[model samples]
Target chain A: MNDTVLVLSIASAIVAGTPILLAALGEIITERSGVMNLGVEGMMLVGGVVGFWAGVNTGSLTLALFLGGMAGVALALVHAVLAVSLRVDQTVSGLSLVIVGGGLSAFLGSSGDPSLLQSPNGLDVNPLFPQSLRDLPAVGPIVFGHDIVVYLAMLATVGAAYFLYRTPSGLSLRAVGEDPAAADAAGLNVVRIRYLATAVGGLGAGVGGAYLTLAVLGTWQNGVTAGLGWIAVALVILAGWRPGLALLGAYVFGGLRGLSFTLQLAEVDVPSDFLAMIPFVAAFIVVVAVSANPKRARRVAAPAALAQPYSREAR
Target chain B: MSRISVEPRAHGGAHVHLGVPVASLAVALLVGAVILAVAGNSAFEAYRTMFDASLNGWTAFSRTLTLATPLILTGLAAAVAFRMKIYNIGGEGQLYLGAIVSSWLALALPADLPKPLMLLVFLVGGALAGAFWASLAAIPRAYLNADEIITTLMLNFIALSLMNYLIFGSMTFWRDPSRQVPGGKKIPESAQLPALSGRLHAGIIIAIVCAVVLWWVLRQTSWGFQLRTIGDSPAAARYAGMSVSLKVLSVLAISGALAGLAGAIEVSGVTKGLEPRSLATDIGFTGIIVAVIARTNPLGVVPVAVFLAAIATSGTALQGIGIQVEVVFLLQGLIFLSVTAGEFFVTNRVSLSRPASTSASGTSTPGSDTAPVVS
Candidate 1:
């Protein structure tokens, strides 16, 4: 392949994979706290629409990204109240939360008039940092030539890995998820930990949604996020609940999807539609493949109290 | 707000169903009315407009009836699968398979065949196709204990993409070339489902009959008992010598067959030709809501299906009134959330005892410990 084609493939793959990576990382945290929020898709859709409108109106990409993250957190708040506070069925409540977010997103989206907006490339062409580094071929421009936000996103992945495993709060969070009753007896605030984890998870989901509208496609369309949110959910399962590996899983799935477009360009002659089904097909395959490793399977950290609603027992 | 208990008025020994289903439905409509009021639309006027558009004249009436037909079958499909604790979200896929098979059957039939016989072939052929399609996930779920929710959901997309490939890419038999819209060939005249009145067809009758038959099988037969037993408690069912794997497979197959039957009926009775967007109809998805609202009861599927059908039919009316087509989606979403939340009331009650609030029944969330005794 030509250098130009290779550069484009990497760039596109990063853009495509960024959302899933962000979402799966967020989910890893949420699940680590023993709460499985299935409303990721809904949260992402809300983020996409809200961020699209905010970016255009404020004429500030930064504000748009911030607002998108807030929107996701806002939706997550309702889920927290229902599943965490009210102690409702996690599956039903999460699904219902999806319904609410989806409906609200679509309705609010209708008023914004999606096509009447333009996306600003939130990037700078400056070659200031280490002149020698800029001169070192495509390993520089394609990867390092990206915007400041991409760098922040990558840093966030590392932060998440550390936050989940290295820190005391992370340990406490894991303890709660593993055994909420034990955590409660140990004097840990299980409810507060869950709420914080969920909100953070939603924030991650929002960033992912904004990445789709602002960086990748640069335009809005109805249901454009498609099933990417769901793919992220499946990614967590594929990652076996490790934040560090989730990044790799995201790129792998993202690369397969990106290659579908490249194959079309190369005239590989396979039905493009069939190739599009690769990620989902890959998701199922990965899940089945991972089933053989008992350690990995057992390591899948779902909070002991993940799906169950918590209502303290009376004395 | 004044607090009132949901207590029985009578004191004598009695057995009367509290009609949670009917009350919950009423609450949904009431909330819908309130939403319309908030949206600057007159609730009463909107209802009248909807009634007029969907059921005022014969044309409108038939449209309503036609819409409800597939919904009934799909609702039943969801009920059957959910009864086994298997959430078969791939109803859309099963529906597509049904349409594909029924369409092919229509094509292969002789021009001289009677309408009744052709209809039977289409229906049975559709059911078998649906069952066969559902097995894709059922096998893996039963054997591997794979998450049914994810597998079934992904399979829906696979099914749609598969059909799209067939009509748009490969399968020559189902393609209707003359049609600008990408769709399958129209069923021959002899194979078409006959109309009952205006545009309502015999498919409605067939769906209703099947629903009644299922209700009997579920409530009055040994097989139905077995399915529910497995559904309610798979471990206990296993201890009782029931084949859990077989039950899972059987329930999914039945669910798939019902969804497939809906697809066949739609093809023969309404569309007469399969198309890319035709199967994208919300019946499969909405049927889940219908099933939940009906509390997974077969007899309850009828009213819930019609109710969902009402909201769907009224969606076009909202479009005509300077509202986005997404309004229908919004209402649909609300229905889903409301029904899911409503199930909480039916199954579990929260009661908090304090100095001011003392009750032996359901109450608020801040309760300490009020789980009811089995005795």
Candidate 2:
């Protein structure tokens, strides 16, 4: 491949991977706190559309990103109320959220001014580094040619890793996930901690959605996330609920995704449709491989009370 | 000091109230109305248009029935598996495989064969193909202890991609070359299901029969009892000598087969072949909503399927009048959310209670398993 093509492919992979990385990191925090919010896809969609709408109206990228994150938070709040407060089945709540978010986004995106769906200039984030640095040989394109979100995603990964492993609050979060009753006995305020974790997770997912609209596509469309959120969920499992590992998993999947487009661009004989199946198929394989040994699966990761509703009186 | 608490109803004493689901539906519709208003559309007129378009006339009603045909079978598919605590979310994928298999069978069969026999082959072939496809996920779930949710969901994408590959890319055996846009070859005329009414084919009968059979099997048969026992408590069922693994595999197979049947029926009865875009709608996903709203009761799936189908048909009709069809989805989502929330109230009773001793804060035992019933 030509240097320009290689540079573009690598750049595209980073851009594609950023959203998944952001969403997966949020899910890791949520799962680490013993709450399984499966509505990441729905949350992302709401974020994407709301963020896009904000961008079109306000013409401010920062406000668009903020609204996108808030949209995710709003959707997550519904999940928190249903799964956390009402003690509804986590799976059911998450699935419902997906339906709601997808439907709402589709309705809003299609019914409004047709022009808004096609943002003229697209929501491209300004590159973090100067043009001179970005144009510097092979190293520049790979390292300096990306927007601010890519950098933030890297920082978030490291920050999340430290927060999860090296901090006292992280220990308390793990304790609540492992044994809420014990955590409660230890004066951890289990409910409050869980609620906060879910909210923070929502914020991360929202930012991911904003990144999709403002950084990647720069336009709004119904189902624009295109199951990226679902892939993010699988990425979390593949990462074993560790934020840093999630970054790695996201990029790998992102590379595979980018490869599909790159191969199509290269006029490869393989069907692009079949190639498109790579990320999902890979996710399925990883999940099956990780879970093949039930004992090992239990021992390795997966928060014990991950989907279990917590009520002080339930036990 | 006062506190609020909830408790599960005593076994066998829980009253099955019709009010809960009804109230949930009412609330959902109210929410939909609010959404419509927010979108600058007349909520009442939109709903009226939907009802009139789908239910006002005999022809319109038949169209709704046609839409409900696949939903009924798919709903049964989800219902049966959910009863066994097996999450078979791969109905969409299974349906696609069923369509492909049934279409292949119909094409391969002698063109001069008797119509009834050809139809029978299509039905059986479709169900078997679906079962086979479901087994791919079921085996891993049963043996490897892999999470079925991820497996089933991932398989859905694979199945859809496989269908696309067959018609659009690799396999040209099923593709209709004459068409500008790629689509599967039409099934033999003999294999096509006869319409009982305007575009409402014999598949409706098959769907109803399956629902009844599933309901009977789940309620009266020993296998059904075993499945239910396992669903309620796997450890207890295992202690009672039930093969948990075997049951898991069988349940998923049955679930997949039912969903596959929906795909087959759609191909044979509705579309007469596959047009990938038309074939891959939200029917399978909607089946999940129907099953849930029906409370995983096979018999109850019939009405739920028709109700959802009516909404879908009406949504399409509204699209003709310049309204977006996504409102249907919004409503469906609202219904699902409200119904699930309603389930909490139905299963558990909540009430406020005052403490015997006056204190600034109520001393209520939270998360206590055997807290005294305040009533």
Best by TM-score: 2
lDDT of 2 by residue, A1-315 (tens): 225677777777887899999999998999899999888998998888888888878878889889989999898888888888778878878888888888877777777766446555456568899988987887687789888889989999999989988999999999999899899998999878888889877888888987887668777777788778889988888777888779888888788888877776666767877887888899899988888766667666789999988876655
- Report the number of clashing residue pairs per model: 4, 8
Q: Give Cα distance to truth, residue B324, candidate 2, Å.
A: 1.5
lDDT per residue, candidate 1, B1-375, as tens digits? 223222112332212123555565567667767866776667687667777877688788678878999999999999888877788877878998898888889998886798779888988999999888888778877876766767776677677777788788764878977778677887888878878887688988888898899999999988899988887688999999998998888889999999999999998888887776767775787787778777688888887787778767877886676555566666667777666655555555433333245554444443334433221
Write out fnat for all predictions, comma-separated.
0.38, 0.74
lDDT of 2 by residue, B1-375 (tens): 566656776532324555677789999999999988888888888999999988889999999999999999999999999888787888988999999999999888897899989888999999999999899889988988787877888888888888888888755778888888778888999989898998999999999999999999988999999998998899999999999999999999999999999999999988887768888997888898899889898888999899999999998778776788888888998999899888777777766866655565665554455343343
Tens digits of per-residue lDDT for model 1 on A1-315? 224667667766766788888888888898888888888888888887787777766767678788988999998887787677656567666766666677767766664333322344332223334656644577765566556666666788899889878999999998888888788889899889999988988988887787677666666665667678878887887777778788888877777778878776666877766776777777766665665456766677445666666545622
Model 1 deviation from native, Cα RMSD in Å:
4.6
Question: How close is every model to the real structure, measured as TM-score?
Answer: 0.88, 0.95
Clashes by residue pair, model 1: A34-A303, A34-A306, B174-B184, B350-B363
| DockQ of each candidate relative to the true complex | 0.44, 0.64
TM-score of chain B of each: 0.87, 0.93
Task: Please give the RMSD to the true structure for each candidate, in Å.
Answer: 4.6, 2.6
Clashing pairs in 2: A123-A218, A312-B366, A312-B367, A313-B366, A313-B367, A313-B368, A314-B367, A315-B369
